[model samples]
Target: MTQKDAPTGADATIPGKLPATGHQGRQEPAAMTSTPTTTRTSTRAPLAAHGTGRVPPRSGAVLAGLCAAVLALSGCGGQKGGSPAAGSVPDGWGTLATSGVSVSYPKAGSGSGGYTVQTAGERSKYNAAAAERTEHGVTVSLITIQLGFTRADTAEDAAIAAEAGIQLGSTIRSTRKVKLAGTGDARRIDFEFGSTGEDRTPPKGTRIEGVILTGLDSKDRTFAVRVDARKGTLPDADLKRIVDSIEVH
Candidate 1:
């Protein structure tokens, strides 16, 4: 794909080192992280309150102080475990919502190949989900949609941070800010990535492409919609349609 904006990785840079990237949104690549340290120590440090310069409340703020150890795959939140995405996905076109955030896509065998799904969990900002369409052993869809929560201060940072998953050795192409339906302060990052072909899927040295769209919902928590596929899988029209279907309630 041609570079529409300009080469920049400012989007993947987390604020003072939060999570790096679930599939990178790069779990926040199912794990790839850098520079973000989330420890499960006491609340005295208040990692969340560091940037705000505001004193943490005396009580009931314990949840606010701890950093979500999402990318690391370390259970470090309110201690809640995870669950499979709720609701049986339809075989045709369908829509699924988690923690009030939603995205629409063609379900597995619905068209455009076979798609599988993952949903949100009970924990806020900890749940992550994705919709994938694959055929045989190779990825057929141009955009595999992934949705997850972030604790960033704004959508600007979160969107920039969702770079990708299993995208070995990804390089930045361009990044630009744009508006999307039902989302606030959205940003888009386009990049080129590589595949190690470890599972003999794409073969060695296969070229992979990815995009990350981070935006804000009503509660100020950030959400990520990331897509990746073999280069030139489809046009931008279908991608736009899938992205426009996203809604954070």
Candidate 2:
């Protein structure tokens, strides 16, 4: 009875109480000690914030500014209203004065009258004055005057000179005698041939009508005036006016 029942409650309590104290200080809850949970962060930008489906404001303004600059530069040059300057010749007519001759031409616009004066000298074979006026869509009128110092003193001589001077390279159709009021007796030579191969102004194979006037001036000079036109372009009255206006001084 001594060993089996000697103080059983005290010994059991001592062994169990030591075990409870040791475990209480060392053990912890699983949620509290899970590697101290580091918060995760993202390194990528959102698609909606960067890839919006529209042109940027800064780029749109730049394009508009470029267009405005181009339009402003285009309006800087060129004549305003498409009209000629002041003190200029009127439309539908032109005047030219040269080589002691002056004439006004019809249907000849400003700066369209062509005049050339050649003097007689050793190097130059002859002295001549030529003028041409062309109505762009209608016809061409040309006048050539040759000064005859030793030859072409008479009307017949002037006619011969004119026949020799004409180099149209086309066939002659007819010749007749005509009287010019201001000038002396004159001869009219007509041609009904196309322009020569060398001439490119008129259409090829087009039958042009030419009227030439050969007259003797008071100073014994020979003047040959040629007026060529597309058929029916120049009226007889207009031709008469142009012929009558010729004056040599």
Candidate 3:
């Protein structure tokens, strides 16, 4: 038998099968090969190392905390209202010894409780020293001491003579006698005076209030201590304390 060519087109059939036009005997489509797919996932690190994921504090807040810590460590923020301890001497006090006198003085500087001592000179017959305390360019308190040897009958007599000479252009406010420790009878005089220039007329707004104390030691030495304040600046108690602390050797 001659092999017949497979039928052409949709009518072709296998040799052993009967010829059929319906699509029942066609070879099934080749099995499809599936490609495997892989999924990739990514992870990110936390914002902070502490792992709590919180942002850092602001710079200003950090600086303020540091300052507060420093202040606390320095111990400088406790007292609100307080006073100096009783029976305690003021700070910055020092001793001044010159020309046979030794005394306690506040700090040393111009307008800050300093003093200058001068011994007897050709123009003056006494040893003198002056201490001054000032505020805002104005003298608030001044202490002046003069020491000399005199041949007067008594300390009071010598002080009166000295006062007469010193009060030439000054107004005497009052005079009295006061007793001092380790000294004989003493004379105290209060005065008010105005500053003068070559014209010999008192200057305006330059009135000074002064107190003078003169007495003699056991060896008949005449000593005088004067204190001057700008019209009401000196406290009586403080002045008394300063004068009482004077020591003349």
Best by TM-score: 1
Instruction: Kindly report which residue pairs in candidate 3 clash with one another.
Output: none
> What are the Cα lDDT values of the candidates?
0.39, 0.32, 0.36
**Cα RMSDs, all models:** 14.6, 54.4, 53.5
Q: How much is 196 displaced in model 2, in angstroms?
A: 3.1
Model 1 weakest 10-residue run by lDDT: 46-55
Candidate 3 displacement at residue 18 in angstroms: 99
Across 137-161, the per-residue lDDT of candidate 2 in tens digits comes to 3223333333432244444444433
lDDT of 2 at 28: 17
Better of 1 and 2 by TM-score: 1
lDDT of 1 by residue, 7-119 (tens): 12211111111122212122122323332422222222211100111112222243333223212221111101222222222335566565645666666655555345532
lDDT of 3 by residue, 90-148 (tens): 45554444453434555546233443332223102222444445454434444544555
If both were scored by lDDT, which would come out higher, candidate 2 or candidate 3?
3
